[model samples]
Structure formats: C-alpha cells, structure tokens
Target: MLPALSTLAAPAPALSTANTGFVLICSALVMLMTPALAFFYGGMVRVKSTLNMLMMSFISIGIVTVLWVLYGFSIAFGTDFGSVVGWSGEYVGLSGIGLTELWDGYTIPVYVFAVFQLMFAVITPALISGALADRVKFTAWALFVALWATVVYFPVAHWVWGAGGWLFEMGVIDFAGGTAVHVNAGAAALGVIWVIGRRIGFGKDPMRPHSLPLVMLGAGLLWFGWFGFNAGSWLGNDDGVGAVMFVNTQVATAAAMLAWLAYEKIRHGAFTTLGAASGAVAGLVAITPAGGSCSPLGALAIGAIAGVLCAMAVGLKYRFGYDDSLDVVGVHLVGGVAGSLLVGFFATGGVQSEARGLFYGGGLEQLGKQAIGVFSVLAYSLVVSALLALVLDRTMGMRVDEEVEISGIDQDEHAETAYDFSGAGGGAGSRRAVPAPDGLPATPGGPASAGRPAPDSTGTDNATGTAPHPKVDA
Candidate 1:
C-alpha cells in the first residue's frame, strides 16, 4: 500500500529546475560549515586538547544526519500535532514519501529540503560542544548530543518552523534560525557549563588559543558558507530576496568585524585576529534572522550592534565565573537575541513581505512577538539541557578526572597527541643533568634528571664522583 501511494505522490507543479539546483547547492554549502566550525574551535583550545575540539564538531555530522533520516525530520516537520511539536512517526525513515514529492510550498524535492535542514540540526548541538570543551568524556558527550537533539532541538525547530507552530502562527519573523538555532544552542551551552563547572585553570592559568590562523580559516569558511545559509532559506531562486540576503550578509559581516575591532581597540588597546574572526561570526549570527526583512543599512546596524555586544558579553564569563571555554554563550545566544529583536525595529516592507517594523510605523507588535520567540526558546533549552547534563553526569560521568585534565585530554582520553616535539633539537639531544637528594650537589647522570644516561655499577656518576655544575639545561 505504501509503495503504491509513493508511486502516485508525484508533485503537481513541475519542479523548478533553477530552484532545485539552487537548493541542492545551498545544502552542500551548509554541510561545509560543520568542518569549518571544527577548525575554528580546534584552534581556540590548547594544543593538548585540539583534537578533541575538532572531534566535537565533526562527530555531529555523523550523529545528526542519521537521526534526521530516521525520525528527527518527522518530529520537526511532520504533520503538526500541536503548537509545540510535529507528529511523531509521520515521516519515519521517510516512509511513504516519494522521491518526486515536493514540500508544501517549496519547489525542491522533499529530501533536498530535509537535507538542508539537516545541516542546521548537525551544527546546533555542535555549537554547545564549544562550551563544554576539554573536560567532557567522548562517550558522555556523544550521548548528550543524541539526547539533546531529540529533547531540545527537534521540538524547538517545530515550534519555529513547523506548519502549525505557535511562533510561526504568531507572526514572528525568523528568516533563518536566530531563535531556533543560535539562541537555543547558546542557552543550552550555558546550562551545561553551569553543571560541568569551570576548567582546571579557569582563572589562574594562562590558557590561550594554540593557533589563531586555524581560527581565521574557520571564520572565513563560516562567512562563505553563511551566504548559502541565509539566502538559501528562501528555498527558491525566482525572487530577488536571495540576492538581497547575499549582499546584506556580506555587508553586515564586514560591518560587524569593524565594530568588534573598534571595541577591542578601545577596551584593550589592540585589535586581535581572534577578535576579528569572532566579530565576523557575530555579524553572521545577527543578520541571519533579519536578512530577508531588513535593508542593507539595517543589516549593518544589526551587525555592528551584535559585534560590540558580543565582544562585551564574552567578558561575562570572567566576571560570573562560568567556564564557557569558547564563548558560545556570548556570541551565539547574545547575537541571536540581538538579531531576532532588532528585526522588529529595522524591518522594511519593500524587498520582501509587507510586514513593517516600528521604525516603519508598524508599532510594537512585531517586537513583542520577537521577544516571545527568543525567551521561550531560551527558557526551554536552558532547563532541558541542564537537566540532560545532570542526568548524564550522575549516570555516566560527564567530566574527566583531574589527572586526565591536567595531563591533557588528547593524550589521556584518546591515547594520541596533536603535536610531537621529539626532534626539535633541544640541547643537541644530550643527556640533561639531575640534582642529588636533599643538599647534595647535582650530577649529570641521575635517576631524577630528564635526560640522564644510565649510571655505572656505582650509584654515583660513572665519569665523576664529584658533583658537576648544578645547572640543568632544558
């Protein structure tokens, strides 16, 4: 019966070749953002923890893709069961859906649209990984991703994008996913970090990024891929809205980068590469929801505001004492809120739909709707994510031991190292000196020394019983 139905379910309107091609390309671009995120995050952690950082982002690609195909899509976009969520099992395993079936209004095949959304689901939880870096166990982290996606992400996606979603029906404007993706992930990140506590050297140690170049590379990739992210939300190529989104994306990102650099110069007296990269990301997050509704100038304002605000927000971790390792809460959550709300003030009715904002004389109705969307998602994500982390912490242990953390998670947890310095030509590979016990003089060949050679039959040094110079070369 399902097979027969599938055969007869061909879309009524012929597929728009241009729209299908555009969506397919956009899906590919969005897929690249996850690996780009890995590099961005990998470079921000210490050398010993770099591989784990990359793994956190890369693992999401595998985990979420499978879930989306199995049941996640159904829960997010299936027949709407209520305002809170879509019906479960409606599209399980994509069962009974034909290859040629088109989504309600989209011109692309249903699977192509599903794949586009799959990229979003993959990256949303990965954003949380940045907050819980270094200390989380791989197994526990994997379990968290699976559970959090089902409990937090899918339902939220439904609330914002599903056919009968409350937020959607309330007339909220989310061009992409400021509420459902960034704010949701950011709130969840804060929740988990609160439960996990701080890193071992949160306040004392000089914990710094190992590679800024890698971070810059990741930022560039994110900027590039986001064009597809924002413009592709249109899901068709017939309209000029896609071009407007693309241009607004570029201008907003550039403006935000400048704004962040200016803020850093005033606050710290120097513009840093990391700040530039972070600012670009802040801009991207800010413009996401507002791109379709806002003009280019509005995008600039949104980006600049987000850049400055996120720059300041990152410092909140230090003041409040939460160990958000990579500032996910600062940039995503804060930036998401800024974008989602600013649209209510900046939206114009010329290029896209005719819903005007307050600045355009639409009053405060849209702003109120935006606030509802933002806070609702934030509240839900925070409570549920914190609960998930606590449960995992109790049952499977969410964090690594102190010894493993101090020794470097890459080596202790993965049994591998990110960098090897064995042949760096330190002291010409000579045996280092070792000091004697108590007040005794230091010797060249002793058990305690880092590079000491084996001693002769006598416990003392083979060449000289007398103590050599006490100095030990590095």
Candidate 2:
C-alpha cells in the first residue's frame, strides 16, 4: 500500500509553454491545409462539380476530429500491439490525460500532441477526394472516410510513427509522413479509384480547371502552411533540426517548381500556371519525408526529380485508361514515392539520425530500409483501401446515378453551386450579353461576347486560346 501510494505521488513530466504555443500554431496551420486543399481541388474541377469538391475535403475535418478523440489517437500513438496496431484504455476518448502531463519525452502536453496528430489524420483522407471528384455519392464518401480512417490510416500511422511499431523499430526514418501521410493517402487514392471507376466523360470532354486564380491561392496557402507541417514535426525548435528542415523545405519547393516548369516548357512547349502550382505541391510532397535528413542541396535534387517524375506520371492515367480526375496518383503517390526513396540517397548523416545515405558512405543499407518502409505502406494502404471501398460500393453504392454525374454533383449532393451566375444572366448556365463598344456588334463566341463560353476551365488549349494540353493539367 505504501509503494502504491508513493508511485501515485510521482510528479508528472514538465511542459514547455514555448513548445506548446508553437505546436498549437502549427496545428492551426495544418488545419488550414485541409480547406486550402479544398480550394486547390475545387478550382481544378469543372464549375458544376466545384462545391462537391470542396465539401469532400471539408467533411473530413468533421469526421476525423470526432474519430480521433474517440479512439484514433490511441490506435495511432497508444501502446503498441504486436508492432501492428496500438491500444490504451486510458486514451479512449482522451479522458485519462491530465492537463499538465507531457507526451512521453516531449516537452509539450500530450493534448497538444494529440491535436496536432489529429490534424494530420484529418487532411490525409481529404487528399483522396480529388481523385474521385464528380461521381461518388456524398453519403458513401462520408462513410468511406470513417471506415478508412479506422482501418487504414490509424494502423499505418502506428506502424510508421508509433514507438515499438515494426517500421519504426526497424530504423525506417519517415521524419514527417512521407510514408505515413502522403504515400498512405496516395496509395489509398489509387485503390479507391480502382474500385469506383472513372468519371463519365473522363478522356473525351474538355476537363479543365475552372479557376486558375483559386488554384494559385490554394497553392500559396499550402506553401505557407507547409512550413509548420514540416518543421513542426520535430515537435520543437529547441534543436537546430527544425531550423534545418525549414530551410530545406523552401529550397526544395522552389527547385521542384522550377523543375516542373522546365519540364513543361521542354516537353509540351509551354510553361503553365497549372504546372507551377502542381510543381510546388510535388516539391512539398517530396520533401515531406526527406527534408529532415537532407541538406538544402539534397532537398533541391529531391524536389526537382520529383517534379519531373510526377509531371510525366500524370499522363499515364490517359494511356492506361484510368481516369484519375485530378492527378492524385501522379502528384501525391508518385511524389511521395520519390521523396521517400530519395532520402536513402540524399540523407546527410548529421541531422535527424545517424543513418547516412549512399553518397555519404552509408552504403545501400539505408536506401533498402527506405524501400521497405515505402512499398510496405503502399501495399497495405492500396489493398486495404480497395477492400473498404469495395465493401462500401457493394452495400451503400459508392457512385451517384449517371444522370446526377452528368448534370453536376453539386446540386445533387449539396444542393448548392459554388458560383451563382444568375445575376449575370438568365440562369446559372446562361451566358450574359456583353454590350458592344459604340456601334460594333459583338461577334459570336468572340472575346467581346459574354455569351462566348469561357476557355476550358483548366487553362487547356481550346477554341479561344492556346494553352498547355489538358492531358498534363492537374
């Protein structure tokens, strides 16, 4: 009884207010990424499906936050079970933690850690929405998010980031979710799309982004928030590791953007705004895992390589007849793979861990470990996500009726349109007449005619303009 009483009196770990504040800010930034992603994906889709695209991402915030509090935090960061999953009765509903209790060795409160991780869980599933835009039933998608988070996301997170998990135990360095978040989400995207099939007019129609400005805005916000996403994974700035990661993140993103533009100019004969935005995202994805271990130079290489690779990969969907509506497979999955593997070749051996890449005399050992981590997560996520999607499709019906898809998913699913052009003309789809200058008559489908249809929303080459080919548009 005395020993028990003494143990009960043991002091809790101290918390750092500075680190706490930093993590809270970082959490906000990551939370913003979900909505930012919505805009990015929203603008890339047709005007009719825009609201649906936004809702698909926004709903994850609601769904995942609830789940994380209930059991997700535990299943991910709880006591490891067989190095596959995790559990803790205390973590159920987040009721057992004290306000002052710190997260294991970290200086921040466990609550802060939990919430930060919760943001990660929220955005991961949101990333898959872009792949299935314009066809899936909203109810089916919501249900899929809940199940996938439980069965796919929670377990994979444990395997990669949890203490005593197999991948973590095996010395695979993910640093900031190259494998856990991006690869996990990307592979899941592929799996679910395979089950659900393609959009009705995938190849034949002029599927272009409705608002390049919105895409740019979202891309800018993502860039802003990603600083917190990458640097905050270090959990604190007490060490210089977070600082190094910050620098690497910027360098890699710039390099990737340039590399993508260069590839576009060389291959397609035009550098496009879409390419710029997609290139930046590719860089961000590539640097997610490798940034902590790499120097600025190494990050530049990783970003550039990923940019070109992902740009090339986006065209494969057309060749193979898989309609990845928004290039989730090309950018996230391929970029995630590029970033995770490049860590093996580019790790500096000084930051994050003692492990070195082949260039630093670390031999092929680290690269091999990275490959194991990369493909294992990819395989698990791809297979399990497909099964979950299949189950949902068979039971609840994953897709909306063909009529709803052709008409537009926004009105069917959400009963709202992103843009109301009614004030401009007769109705949302009607074109307004532009007043002709002086005595000049407005030419049909001409620049002066408001009745002229807008250029293909994605900035693709169309009747009115010559832009980049739609095949490479994200």
lDDT of 1 by residue, 259-325 (tens): 9888877776667788899999999999999999989999889999999999888888878888888
Q: What is the C-alpha RMSD of each candidate to the true structure, in Å?
A: 10.4, 5.3
Off by over 4 Å in 1: 1-12, 88-90, 423-474
Listed in order, each prediction's TM-score against the native is 0.87, 0.90
Q: Give a tens-digit lDDT track for model 2, residues 1-474.
A: 356776777576478899999999999999999999999898888877889999999999999999999999999999999999999988999999998888998899899999999999999999999889889999999999999999999999999999989999999989888999999999999999899998886776777788889988999999999998999999987989999999999999999999988988888777788889999999999999999998999998999999899888888887887777888888999999999999899998999998999998899999999999999999999999999999999998999999999878887787666764434432334444444566565532323534445444333411111245545564
Q: Give lDDT for model 1.
A: 0.84
Clash count in backbone of candidate 1: 0
Global lDDT of each candidate: 0.84, 0.87
